[model samples]
Target chain A: MSEARKDDTILDVKNLQTVFFTNSGLFRAVDDVSFNVRRGETLAIVGESGCGKSVTALSVMRLVPDPPGRVVGGTVTLEGTDLLSLDEAEMRKIRGNRMSMIFQEPMTSLNPVMRIGDQITEVLRLHQEMTSREAWAKAVEMLRLVRIPEPDRRAQEYPHQLSGGMRQRAMIAMALACRPALLIADEPTTALDVTIQAQILALIVDLQKTLGTGLILITHDLGVVAQTAQRVIVMYAGKKVEEAAVEDLFENPKHPYTRGLMASMPAVISFGAKTDARLNEIPGMVPSLTNLPPGCAFAPRCSLAIDRCRAEYPPLQEVDGDHFAACWRAAELVGAP
Target chain B: MTDQRPLLEVTDLVKHYAVRGGVLRRRVGTVHAVDGVSFSVAKGETLGLVGESGCGKSTVARSVLRLVEPSSGAIKLNGTDITGLSKAEMRPHRRSMQIVFQDPFASLNPRMTAGDIVGEPLGVHGLATGRAQQERVAELFGQVGLRADQMKNYPHQFSGGQRQRICIARALALGPSLIVCDEPVSALDVSIQAQVINLLIDLQRKNDFSYLFIAHDLAVVAHISHRVAVMYLGRIVEIADKTELFANPRHPYTQALLASVPVADPKAKKLAPMIDGDVPSPINPPSGCAFHTRCRYVMDRCKVERPTLVKAGGQHEVACWLNDGTGRAENS
Candidate 1:
């Protein structure tokens, strides 16, 4: 664990700006987002839907299609090499070989006609130029690594033939086939049930420890993050609002938005018989990026919003130790319900 | 004191779909979707049905609602047998029982406004006419925490939470005594899920309505339900109070299911029992005990002889060979 913390940065995303060209206007789906994952640690990007968490992950991998989406600005550096500067062919080589991404929906991400073994072997053969026999053997090995039962029988089955949990396991197997240094998982267990979710999270954590892989886990479930992630990045409306150690974020959340999110979690401890126990809900919906307010994006909903909050955007400042919060009144907003 | 006169009583409810095969499309096998499941919901209590995916929890819900006709069973609503009633005959009782589906966006009619969606129930039941119907729809909107003026808005215009509220308002239009909520909050985000769960709790308190809340999330279910029932491959393996089910689960399957839920607090260490292998296919389920294949304490008797639901402790019942003391001599 100490060595993982000291390893060189595997991924450094700086000031990444992703925009969506809709009929309405150019919407900044990812606005000046920046984060980094250590060589063997997990950095979780936590946010609700439409909060640009997935958009930021997609931007890093350059998977966002160009017709309706485009990465207008950013420097995605892997081991000091600028990924954005690379050409399409070079980036393609780096994508599956260096930094693989496991998408949210395995049912759609997987090739319908291809066998599970062949799908993984295809990545190996395409990237490493391995023979069919070699790729198949490597594919089976990868499946076994993920702890998928009866790897041989499972490899012969098609994607549709496997269950949802098995398909997700298969997706993870494919992502880790090339021994990618950084694995970006976007809501990997969202479609799964609680029991299956626990298993998947444990598997990911175990694999990370064993393979010494850096992970960027993007999810809305705080429970998943609490168990797996070493650091947590809180996002809202295309902006990075808070970044801190997982324990710090849970124990002493500085940002009003983060506090509200933490309070809203229906834990067994917080709930009681009282029906009127008002949850700390940050009122109002997430503002549309097409028509974002000039000041702080969260000001419209934040309870701690003051005149300054409504007038100017706040820079991400270090609040306590290594904890960072992008709020105008981060100091004043203490012990928020 | 068991209430024999509960609002809804389901006895050995079973729903099996026949697998078609060969050129003639003959029934080769039966998929035991909801096999011999039983439970009762009192007047206003919420009996949460929770299990993993492919555990047949949803099938039990659909069977109880009569949405998907049960293959064989007894469904008694308010002491009246409603299971055998045909579609046309069940029309009168439809108002007293409603369902709030999982995906509100898909369940709602796209062409209809929010007002029409809620008002359709009243119109179908012939409970209101013209002006009276509009007033009732407005009232229903207010009950579900939606603004009455926004009745003209379409489903697409509302957010995910608001859309689900619309579904709830529609379900509550007829003042149903029981509303089967099937994974209502699973589709929403964490914050939004809290809002909807709170709303459901508040509404139930006000109306004294009974709910068959079915979801895969055990934490949410534990918070809302007074009693919880754990389901395996189309069977209620264990049924107990929420606290008991959480603290001292009897059956191995129930224990494993409860152990698997990840707590939000990282400091709290729980020994989660890992159940290896995927749920066996419903097409050809395990012979004796549906959960015997995955049960850590499987016995020889469990492979051949099925265990029926019997009283294990106070106000709790379990259908496992271990609990019945009929499996192995060693304690489970």
Candidate 2:
């Protein structure tokens, strides 16, 4: 990569792997995943449950619980610094300062007993050299930035006292209080109503642009990905099955799994259109990550799977410029150009 | 085929729970869960009721099935008023109307086999027994696209989608004319959700049954329902044929909801401007029109007087003042 390109890249994750050990045996939760987020761009990691999307975010933050899970291999490079080699103290200083994350559920993520303003102020005090009064003022300002009405009054309220949408806004305020270069949000708007979800999504996108922050949005909703993300990564059973620009992936998905997922979603029909169409189904359930089939993880459910698919795992190959797929018959897939 | 006479009719359904406060537990206010709601289902039609949380859609479903007693209303099933029936008389009516809950895992008893769970309804109503019930159970299993052999396993052994199928099979065992499905496929994954939805549609075709399908997701509702009703607070804001409702929504709430749905197309146009505030509390809901707090076209009369459903055009009915000749002249 050129030096200028490296300078623009805010987060570069290469060959990432995370594994968990249970009584049933150890299984790879995230396997050989790689991606990069440029400054001011939104990169979405889309997948179903247990497909290791959330684990990938945790791995990047070095927040994976150690007893049963660990990031065994990979290099997470954040703005020219190798995060894996950093000591605990140094990593703590970098975290919530240069990078931050917003989890899916705000009710549990925020401290229940503490006032919302205090929670945001704690991050400012711990990470930056700010006095108590300065931190409190910055905390209220952050709430205002997230479009929370009555920021001064709302800052004194507890998490439970506020509505679901308000709690989520507070979470965003706390996450963005430091103005981090990289923001990782895992399904931030999944719990709210569609109207409220639109409000929250618009807020996130607007803030990202203003701050010039590189965003890593992890979600299972295809509609959200299409509306918000610039680039996309499709994951299936702990592997990156396809990667492409949002338009290219939706228009011409190269991987069979990606194509199946898109087909399964029932689109909101246009006005006055007939409603006789049945939604396309991917016949079988997602394979268990612990006891996966030998070759491709998705072979049992893929309609195009052949003998070769069951015999060998396909390597990620470039199907077109900046578009990649891990399917053995990527060229033969019906939507592939 | 839809019959001339509707299979179920719910008229002026009102259910309210009292809110107690202080040490004496005095009735301070009432939570208007479902207030004066009315709708009907044809013999084989599916009526999709959609709204956000705390909007009383679930309350309407529960009232229709008489699971929770409604404070006041008339529920007529097959031309018979079943609202005032005693528990003993309601037993026979229960066989004709069944309910499928959202969480399949919590609904089914873990200790019981899938076959026994499906056959429980038969035994309860004394519809079948012995080898006859076994044959009926196996038939229902096959009807729901589950293998007869898998019926011997417990609910734990089955996947989420399979558990939902078992719930459907149980509901089918009674041979009901109407089934109230409360977010049946919301718990499943996207791929599995599609499979279950297809199965439901196919089963409805074969059995010629009516469904009062309730969900918060509009796309799924658009695909499955013949007619759609949009609920706000505790009232139906708009009700119309699926095509008409989506194409020409008259109510401000209904229009805002349709515009809020994020389309799957990446290059799709920007989302329409959405409503600003959260749904108000149901306990002390906004007076007069419940949706005036967030409505964009609210007028002076809207805050003082409530609007009832009136025919806008064709079969479409809306409760907004704008559509009832009270607000804007262009809309009237």
Candidate 3:
């Protein structure tokens, strides 16, 4: 949890800025975002749709293509080495080996033409330089590790022959084939059903514990973060508004946006209560990144906004022990810890 | 219990699609998409149908509406058996029961404006003409939380939440007593989802319209439904009051589903035994209990003899062999 921990700093991002140049204008999808992932811990980047949570994860893996999106500034350091400085070949070597990423949709991520085992072995053969027989054996082992039933039979089936949950398990098996130290799962359980989602979550938790792998979970659902994440970072309009321990963030959120999100979520405890006429909601849509306000991006919709909030941008200040919030009136609005 | 006449009732409904194969295209198998499913919505109650994808929840919704013709069953709307009614004969009852689809973008006609979309039902049923149709459309716009003046705007001009509101207005044009809402809020953002849910609740209160709300979201379903029916592999595994279903689910599938929902409270530490393996395909479902393949407490007989839905307690029914007073029933 510390910035100076020697073995804890698995992935460090500094002043990351990602911009997309389109026909309309230049838009900052991720603006000066900075965060860190500790070894063997889950760090969740939580936000609404289009809050740069996914873009930050893509930037970390260098997955964003060059024509529309470009990393204009910042550094991504993995195990004390700057990944941005690496050449294409070196980065490719590091991609599936040292750091791997799982996409949102497993159905679209897996190739339909390739068998599940071949796809998994493709990574092993490319990175580990193993023989075909050895790679196939390793692929079967990986499938079994992911709890796939009848691993030998499942390995020979194509991606289309599997169900949504099975395809996701296969995707995870492929990502973990090289035993990466850092895993970036982008909404891995978003499209899955609740029962299957719980299984997948438990699998990730078990795998992280077994492998001591650092995790960066990006999702819009607060429920997923509450169940899995250790530390939480809240983003809005491509800016980090709050960061705190998972327990502290939910119990005593320091930012208005975080409070609104928590209040808007319908919980089992609050079911069938006819107490209030109006539920807590943040009015208005998220502002376009291209047309962001100069000072505070959320000022237009924030009820507690003041003149000072509209004149200057607020810095992320440490309000409590290991808790950071970027709001001018954080202490007044949320009360001092 | 006081009123025996429900707005909509489905009894022993079944739908199967024949799978063809080989060079001559012979029917080799049948996919039992909806097999012997039954549920009912009272005069003003919202009955939520929730399950995983490919669990036949949508098929039940479609069958009740007679959209995809049911192979065999009885669907009664206002005491009239419309299951065997021909297309021409069923046209009169179309205004009594309507549907609101999940995807607002795909459901609404792109070339038509909001006015035309909402007024189509009115024109089809000959309920109103020219000026009256325009007035009805404007009134519906205001009812579903949209501005009457924006009726001329197209679906493309509205946000996802607003477009769904337009769809709701269209469904309300015929003054239907029942509305089949199939995942209406699943495609929307969380904030917008709350808005749409609240709107649906409000409309139901004001108009006394019953809803067969089908969705995959447990929390949202628990919020708006009076009674809930949990489906798994084309079967209604559990049916009970919303409070009882959430608090004390009897069926194993329902228990696992309720347990899997991530609680908002950080201090909560309850975890259920997660079901393993994917749901078996309906085309070739397991011989006995379709859920036995993934169920944690699967018995030997579960792999051979299917269970029947029966009354367990007060207003609660379950279709599990465990609740039938026998550890496992003998296979026939």
Interface RMSD of each: 2.9, 1.7, 2.5
User: How do the residues B1-332 of candidate 1 rate in per-residue lDDT, one tens digit apiece?
Assistant: 14658999999898999999999999999898888888899998899898877778888878777888999999999988999898898887888888988998899998999999999989988999799999999998998888989999988999888999999999999999999999999888777887888889889879988999998887778778888898888888888887766766778877677667666666664525368777899899888988888878888988998888777778877888874542222223
Query: How closely does chain A match the true chain A in each prediction, as TM-score?
Result: 0.95, 0.97, 0.96
Tens digits of lDDT, candidate 3, B141-254 = 999888988989989989888999999999888888999999998888777787888888888878888999999999888877888899998999889888877777778888
Model 1: runs farther than 4 Å from truth?
A1-7, A268-282, A333-337, B1-4, B269-273, B323-332
Docking quality of model 2: it rates as medium
Candidate maximizing DockQ:
2
- Worst-scoring 10-residue span by lDDT in model 1 chain A: A269-278
Worst 10 residues of 2 chain A by lDDT: A268-277
**Highest lDDT scorer:** 2
Off by over 4 Å in 2: A1-4, A270-276, A334-337, B1-3, B269-273, B326-332
Per-prediction DockQ scores? 0.43, 0.67, 0.45
* lDDT (Cα, tens digit) per residue for candidate 1, span A27-103: 98899998888878999999999999999988899888898999999799987779888889989998888899987
TM-score of 2: 0.97
**Residue pairs in steric clash, candidate 1?**
none
The DockQ for candidate 1, computed on C-alphas, is 0.43
